[model samples]
Target: MYQYTDFDRHFVRQRAAQYRDQLERHLRGELGTDEFRALRLQNGWYIQRHAPMLRVAVPYGELSARQLRQLAHIARTYDRQPDGPFAGQGGYGHFTTRQNLQYNWIPLVDSATVMELLADVDMHGIQTSGNCIRNITSDAFAGIAPDEIVDPRPYAEILRQWSTLHPEFAHLPRKFKIAISGALEDRAAIGWHDIGLQLKRDDAGHIGFQVFVGGGMGRTPIPGIEISPFVAWDHILVFIEAVVRVYNLAGRRDNLYKARIKILVKAEGQKFVDAVNEEYRRILADDPAGHEQLIPQAELDRVKASFVDPAGVKAEPAVTLDDGDPAFARWLARNVHGHRLSGYRAVTLSLKRVGIAPGDMSADVMDTAAALAERFSHGELRVSHRQNLVLPWVREADLAELFQAARAAGFATPNAGLLTDQIACPGGDFCALANARSLPLAAEIAERYQDVDELVDLGEIDLHISGCINSCGHHHSGHIGILGVDKDGAEWYQLTLGGSDGSTLSGTTTPGKVIGPSFAADEIADAIEAVLNTYQRDRLSGERFIDAVKRLGLDPFKTAANAVRVSTAKAPA
Candidate 1:
């Protein structure tokens, strides 16, 4: 993990003080709600359905055990639990898709105090929201993945520093998201971000990036188009600046809905590419030092040095486990992943426990995770894009003990990449923008498929649910996507199938196709079961859910889903 320098610490403290001053002014009537809106957003404060929400940045999803403890402390002190039969125990935090942590019950007056707490741990809410470049994400398995071409953490950190408060892009047309993937697998979902950088090796074994631009999801979901097939590692910053410059100058600013770079690219098409190329040429020509000045080698070296691989890990002979626990074996198969180093594996601590909101973590759970990370994973952890915490360097020998600890903490669900492990957003329960509640649907689906054998049969399914078209839950990229919609003031779900984040190694990513009419909330789980049943019955030997759906189109699955819905509607009362 990157250690915060004195300058970084000072900068965060200063930013927190500034925000505190702003909050005081707002409370004193020096600033009205409208006047304080932009300022609050920049500081990661949102006036939600019932209370204020605060989003704290976890850069590149890296967290030290100390930082995790601080986050737990913040949750314990600042968040509130509603009083009711449905009320959860207090001190819970929500992990978001962008690798940030959000608190839903923050009070307006306590915003500054929250920022100060984050600053103490070298974390902050800066650039987490508002029309600025948001948190930069990278492959969770960056340095340790077996198939990695290069570690993306250094480059991500460089981008984080450059874009944190860049005066030129502070108020761009809209917010921007950037993702970097070093592994052959597209775990970072690079295709759906505003800017995607995939590390690649040339024929001469030189490292560089394949740049994709204007990819985003919302009302208009589009995969990013490649702007540069290959960019030299040293010149990536220059290329990024060129892209941003073009978007800032040519993107629509009058209409908030049309202000994203994706809209500009969609409207202009090839013309946008030509403009970006022209800008790149101008930027290159303006550099007297031949683009080397953009990202100095020394700066790269400094960042790279911070990410040295862990030492003292030795290769061990392959060991077989005979714990006689089918549950343990199931967890090992799904939650554990291959590591670059032998005798070591990356373990995902699932937040998707049945009946709980996806990505929700209590304060005590965070402390347990921190302790486990420190004891077994070199005191470091990574947050996955799939809303789970990853112990990136756990030794295989520690597997049993770690599993037991995680299970006790409710983090060991043995359901990674399965139907029960779904990506979801905090919907109508928290966000004012949501059309319907998402957590209940996710819980119901998980409960329906709680049987271990059933999930294994389902196999590698990516089910995502979003409360609205904002697509915060990444429903557009799921194998079975559920989108919440409001029709005639009633909650309904629109199901989409065959969508994927695309495999970069195999070169395939397609958006989900809508199957049929939206179904009522009560019918959602059965509708999903019908789709699963159709896949199980029709799939060839050893075919995954998404692959089967791709081989066989939506018609069969649609038929089964509609049949279930219709049968339920016509059932005797």
Candidate 2:
């Protein structure tokens, strides 16, 4: 596990103090509630339905056992320790869609204390949330993945250091999310980020990044434009700076809803990419040391050293996932992924347990997970881009028992990377930004596909839902995606198909129409069923629904949904 340096410690401590001062002044009637509310959000604080919520940034989804222990202490002391039916009656904590954690209830006064606690552990709330540089995510299996070209952890860490409270870039027009994945796997969902980078190696064995700029899902969704290619290791930061520069200068300022990098990329098109690249070339040409070729080998090496591989791990016999652990067997197949380490696999604890809101982990669960991290798996833990907690390096032998234990702790879900493993943002129920509560829509979908056998039979699918265009639910990347909006002062839902997160040139096909404002959860499922049935009849054996839908066109799905509505309406009325 990586330990914090003195420089890291000082930076967080100072940030905590600065926040403390700001909070005190706000409470003393110096700053208005509206002003303080915005400021507190920058530090990952949110006033949820029940109480104040504090989202703590777990950088790159990395957590040391000590850090986990400290998190447990915060849960136990400052908030209700929810383990039973009503323990966390009002609130506790929930890990989110991004790689972060949130304490659902904490006093404003306790905010400073929590900051001090995190700072003591060399953590900070700075840049984790709000309309600033958010948590930088990368391949959770960066080093461990067997097929990786190189470890992405070092590059991620370097970017983290450079972007944290950057002097000139702090206040952006909107939030920014940067993701990097090693050439091993698309674990970081590289296609659905503000800036997605993949570390690649050419025939010459020179390491560089394939940069994707402006891919995001919010009010509007678009695949990132490939503005540049084969960015040499030394020029990674410079290339990113160039991308940001283009966004800063050209991004929409008139409408808050239209201000994301994706929107900019969409409006600008290919000419924009070419223009930006030309501008970047000019900048580098004018001052090679000042721009593209300025990053030092020493700095890169210093970052590389911070990431030390897990020690004392040994390969052992594979656990019998099928024998006496059918529940775990399904889970292992869906959630566990191969690693670079010969004997290790990366496991995701499916927090999306049926009826409960996805990503909502209780405090007790967090503590238990922390304990489990220390005992069975490596002390390091990670959170996934898809709103799941990851035990990064579990040995093959411990798979079954780990799954059983995880089941007891509200995990053990086998629908990872499937339709039921849906992505939803905190909708109208909690978010001021949402038009409808996305969780209910997600729950409705989960209900429709509850049977594990049926879901498996359906095969691999990505179903993403967002309450609004902001796309917190990531509706843009789902093979079958749903978006909710308030039209004519009523909630209306839209469907889009053929969007994939792992493929080249991924984007939604023809957009679907606006459904009713009073659309029931069952209605969404009905529409999806119509789509699936069409695929079942049309598709060849073994073809995935996404592939089938792409082959036959989305009109079939549309016809099914429309037919269902007409039949149900005409017969009942």
Candidate 3:
């Protein structure tokens, strides 16, 4: 994790103070709602369907245990839903696919205080929302992954500092996202981002990036195209600036639907690439500060130095645990992962248990997680893009003890990549943009698939859900995608098969195809079960769900799903 310098600490505190002043003025009626909207959005505050929602940025998903403790304090003390469906039920935080944490019930009047608290811990929501470069995400197993080409944290941190409040690209046509993957596998889902950077080395052993541009999800789901095969690591910032500059100048502003850079890139095609190249050439030749912007060796070294392994961790002899206990064996296989270091193992603290909404960690759970991090992970923790907390530095010898503690803490479900480990968003219940609720449906599916044996037999499945077309839950990337829709004021869901997140398991980055017409909300779970049953019956030996879907096509699964879709009148309560 990058340690904040004195300047970095001061910057967030000053920004928090500025936000407080702006919030006070807005509350006092001195600032109009429309004017204050932009001000508040820049600081990551949004008025949702029921109340104010605050999204706190977690850069590259790294967090200190102290920071996690403070977050728990904030949730316990200030987060409460006073009205709507969730009135009196709060004090929990929701982790997002973007690796940010959201609080849906925070009062607007108390938001300034929350900002100040965040600043105290060198954290803030600056540039987390609105039409700007959002928080840069990377593979969760960045530094410790065995297949890593380079440590991407330093570059991701450098990008984070560069894009935060950049004068030129603060506001673009639409919200922009960038993801980097240093691993051989695309764990960060880089192909689905506006700018996807894959860290690589040349034949001469020099670092560079393979850049992809224009991918996104929504009404139109398109994978990004390779804009540049390899850009020198030192020139990444300048090249990215050129790409954004082209989009800022030419991207559509007429319709919100067509305002994204993806749309612009799609429309312009090779012309867009040509324009970006021209812009890159001009920046280096014509712009006064362009050459100066190229990262110097000393700056790179300074950033990389902070990413070194913690002082206490050492390379010890490798060992494995094989207790007679089946539960322990299951947890060891599913929740634990191999580490680059000899002795260390990465363990996922499951947040997908039944009863609680997926990724919603209560105050107690957060505090316990912080304690677990301190005790086992060198006081550092990581928030995975899949909305789970990871102890990235747990010693191999500590697996049994950690498992026992984690089980007591309610996060040791041993279903890390299983069918029950679903990804969902706070849908219509909280988000104003949602057409239907996602939590209930996710809960229903989770409740049905509790047996670990059953889940393992089903294999690793990415079942993602979204309330609307916004794709916050990344439903388009799921092997089993469920998208909530509206039908004459009733809730319906559209099922899509064969989506993937571009991992070793999910081979490619592609959108799932809808099987047929949408099903009533009540019939969606049955429809999903029917599809899964079809896969179990017809799949070849050792075939995964995604492979079967691809090999057999969507016809049989479509028939199975349609067979289970009942009429609105026939839907069970």
Using lDDT, give the best candidate's number.
3
Across residues 1-573, which tens digit of lDDT does each residue of candidate 3 receive? 999999999999999999999999999999999999999999999999988999999999999999998998898789985643324544888999988999988899999999999999989999899999999999888899888999899999999999999988887999999999998988899989999999999999999999999999998999899999999999999999999999999999899999999999999999999999999988888756644878988999999999999998879998867678999999998999989999889999999988878888877789999999999999999999888999999999999999999999988999998888889999998999999999999999999998889999999999999999999989999999999998878998899999988788998789999988898987899999999999999999999999999999999998888887556455323
Q: lDDT of each structure?
A: 0.87, 0.75, 0.91
Off by over 4 Å in 3: 82-90, 287-291, 568-573
Q: Residue 244's C-alpha lDDT in candidate 1?
A: 94
Root-mean-square deviation of Cα positions for candidate 1 versus the true structure, in angstroms: 2.4
lDDT of 2 by residue, 9-63 (tens): 8888988898899899998999999999878987888886656778898777777
Could you estimate the TM-score for every candidate? 0.96, 0.89, 0.97
Root-mean-square deviation of Cα positions for candidate 3 versus the true structure, in angstroms:
2.1
TM-score-best of 1 and 2:
1
What is candidate 2's CA lDDT for residue 45? Answer: 85
Off by over 4 Å in 2: 47-51, 79-91, 282-293, 314-325, 487-490, 503-522, 566-573
Worst 10 residues of 3 by lDDT: 81-90
Task: State the lDDT at 72 in candidate 3.
Answer: 84
In candidate 2, what residue range of length 10 has the lowest lDDT sum? 509-518
User: RMSD of each candidate?
Assistant: 2.4, 3.5, 2.1
Kindly report which residue pairs in candidate 2 clash with one another: 144-340, 145-340, 146-339, 146-340, 218-469, 218-470, 218-471, 219-469, 219-470
lDDT-superior candidate, 1 or 3: 3
Question: What are the runs in model 1 whose C-alpha is more than 4 Å off?
Answer: 83-89, 291-293, 314-318, 504-507, 566-573
